[model samples]
Target chain A: MELDLSVEIAGLKLKNPVMNASGTYDPLRYESLVDPNLLGAVVLKSLTLNPREGNPPPRIVEVACGIVNSIGIQNEGVEEFIKVKVPLLRKFKEATFIASVAGLTPNEFAEVVEALEGVDIFKAYEINTSCPNLEKGGVNCALDERCIQQVTKAVRGKTNKPVIVKLAPDVTDIVAIAKVAVDAGADALTIANTYRALVVDLKSRKPILHNVTGGLSGPAIKPITLRLVYEVVKALDVPVIASGGITSANDALEYLLVGAKAVQIGTMNFVRHDIMIKIIEGIKKFMVDEGIKDIKEFIGTLRT
Target chain B: MKLVECSVTHNLRVRPEYHILGLECGELGSIEPGQFITVSVDSVEMVLRRPFSIYRVFENRGVIEIFFKVVGKGTKALSELKEGMAVSVLGPLGKGFPLYEGVTAVLLSRGVGLASLALLGDKLKGLKSRVVTIASFKGRDADLASDNEYVKSFSDEVIVLYDEDRSSDVENVRYLLNKVKPDVVYTCGSKRLVRLLKELPYEAYVAWEERMGCAVGACRSCAVRTVAGYKLTCYDGPVFNVRDLIL
Candidate 1:
């Protein structure tokens, strides 16, 4: 018998436990690679109030194990995304649309949420606290509880839609900052954004990335993301969306077993575009083989 | 997007010291100028595909020709390619340069930066552009790997410039600008020549080269900072208006 794949998080039931991560697979560009209709949901790149061209070149620096990127949230802003990207993305087959957003100020965050209102394609918002909080000392908003509460409250006040706070992994106590967001009325949380890192060229005697710093992702960060997911699950009663270094079906399964209601695929999709579909199908097969009828049955149920 | 193999029948060097490695891929079968191919050069050292512009494609003895220079790690790896060893390739990407259909007096290159104009010379010849192919040398004994035979085959009018030292390149550049006085100027690899031509009163397109991280416009690595904005050299152009770029 086929297994029931629906999994609920933040009052919405995902058709499956997997969603393409923000900033990884863009449906507008790779439409030919996959049937967007097959995806559970597609989280878009981080949007801001103003369009950003992103960082200068030498943006990518290859490391020993993986890669680092200083893309600086290059996006077409919320206005263009609604005008151009939404109508195209709405064509996806039963896929929920999650808008990932970044802003320098709390007001900036609210402005985009308010702008996106009435767009049926937008189901929820992921407040990217990982973005360099320009108002602060270039320290990410996720690093400070006060910044988290301010941005969360501003966004929550504007729209009744569920908000998922995407926290940066560069913080000292992520749980405290998460609790601050939860207290300020965020519906759920996505544990960990890309970790801050760097690489250098031996010949040039200079940093590899032009920006000198970038976010590191891939197989190297899986354990850290998983640990964060476990801690967030233990701390908060609300749902947790786990992301970072999820490259396989088992990786998704592990996130679910640890406590993530949904898993977002990031850099792995660039290397293998079909990894999302493979993971989704694999989850169903595991459920069938285990005689499990639904995805919730596996959430946080690690065999002791 | 046909992928064909080209063998290195001959590797010659010309004045201004540029490596002209020729591959007998096949009868490029109606190849145009400005088109490029992604060539794979693999070993224990590096593992990635390097894209090279089809410098010159010719049909002789039923074999196609693809030419390139030793510019980067990929090119270095390609240069080390044995005369008989086969290399994998993906080809003829993007639109090629427009061969002037009318009798247009285009300023041909006369220095080391002449690679950009090499293919254009052949294309212009086909369309029969006044074909003023002017080439020059850096200095005496500066003939990198001067092969007299290969030089005679390409140029319609080769202008050899003799400079004493470092400053002669600038004076030679001014002389060519005045002598050619052509309607349009096209350049390939030299930033110095492109910058020089930018001041001249002529429509020019400087062929740009940047390290392409992902060629399919995904990474946006090979972007040239133009006056308008950052345009992808791979997608938007491997060519741009001389005035549009900062050089």
Candidate 2:
């Protein structure tokens, strides 16, 4: 039987369930290797109001099975993204682009959404709520119900497009925050962001990352993130786009089996630039072997 | 730059600390010196590809060789790679050193960083009446016969300095720079050297080494802080003008 890998969430249609996690892949750079037309959606880097220089190096350290990064979301801001990037980005006529919005405040989040609303190329917006909220006093961690509510509502008020709230997995009550975001008008939830982590230099007796602590992503966090995703998917009625450390079709399948509408490939893109193509092929082979006709029938079908 | 999954043609260990990895690049040999390639150590345990300068590429033979030192897990795993083992090799990525005809230039490098300069030195020697001088700095144990021979093939002169003697000291290095007084100079992966070169009279460039991710400009992990915001060490340059750097 001919298998169908297409999926839809929050009214946005994806040709397949594979896409690069925000900040992990660049379409302009990788387009020569991995065709953007084949990916479900091209997720760009997180954009703030103004251009950011990010943090000072050393920003990343490779540990056992993963790496920790404090990139500080260095980006060209929404204006530059619309001006410099969009002109080049428009060339990919068949490619669906998803903009990741980040900000220091709720009003700032909506402002970015408003700035990008006129851009005709974007199909959706993925909200990176991991920014340090001025009112919250620390990294939002995407867990504060009041903050998630305001950020989601403010962003929702500005655009009619889909708003995906990317949450952090280190929190005590993810389901509560996920529910708050859904109620506040988030059309979807990227079940988790990078896991909060730290690495130290034995000789200097200091942290490796300039920011001291960073977000960890790779195969190391796959199992832990899968569990967190399972819990969130079981509780929320809204769509959940899984994002922790999906390196393979098997990992993506596991997330889909747990009810994730789609999966985002993160750290592995650094290891192998053509990994998404291999994964899309791997998922296709899996469907042929399992006699699955369409991807929707296979999603959320975990055998308990 | 394209990603090629090629088999290892050779993994010749120059010493316990250094090895030269060779992979078959099919019709993929258009690269300049100081340009780098990120090799995915290809272990699930490793999260990022390790970037190495293009030591040599034989287009006819369809082979690309990378010189690396075993400083960490990535290189350690790369050292164990055998002939015919499949590996994911990306690039040749990032900017290479800028070249000019008939200009006197010096290749100054530290330890394994010498690999980044050899290809450029070879190219510089081909130009009309250009003088190529190599000033290599090594630690007590880092001095290798192969390094001397490799740089000697294209360089007009070779001056070896080591930690065993203070000849490689900043003052001595400054004195040597004045003696040669070349039109332009090139260095590799040394902050002290780059900083020193920036204060000198002649034009200088550096092949920057950084902890890289995505190798493309995507992740922004390997950022080199410049007077004009930040540039990615992997994408913007493995080679950059000394004046443009804040180091």
Best by TM-score: 2
- Model 2, A221-252: lDDT tens per residue? 98988898888888889988988778888989
Write down the TM-score for model 2: 0.97
Which portions of model 1 miss their true places by more than 4 Å?
A: A1-6, A90-95, A202-204, A272-301, B1-174, B177-190, B207-223
Considering only chain B, report the TM-score of each candidate against the true chain B.
Answer: 0.79, 0.94
Q: Interface root mean square deviation for model 1, in Å? A: 4.9
| Model 2 residue A15 CA deviation in Å | 1.1
How displaced is residue B98 in candidate 1, in Å? 5.4
Please, what are the lDDT tens digits per residue for candidate 1 over residues B65-183?
44454556666666666676676555555556655665544534434445556667766756666555444445666532134333345445555545555434856666766777776
Residue-wise C-alpha lDDT for candidate 2, range B132-185, written one tens digit per residue = 554544665676533567667777777777767877787788889889998999
- Indicate which candidate wins on DockQ: 2
Give the TM-scores of the predictions, in the order they appear.
Answer: 0.74, 0.97
Q: Which residue pairs in model 1 clash with each other?
A: A37-A93, B5-B25, B6-B25, B7-B24, B26-B64, B27-B64, B116-B188
For all predictions in the order shown, the interface RMSD in Å is: 4.9, 0.9
Local distance difference test, candidate 2? 0.86
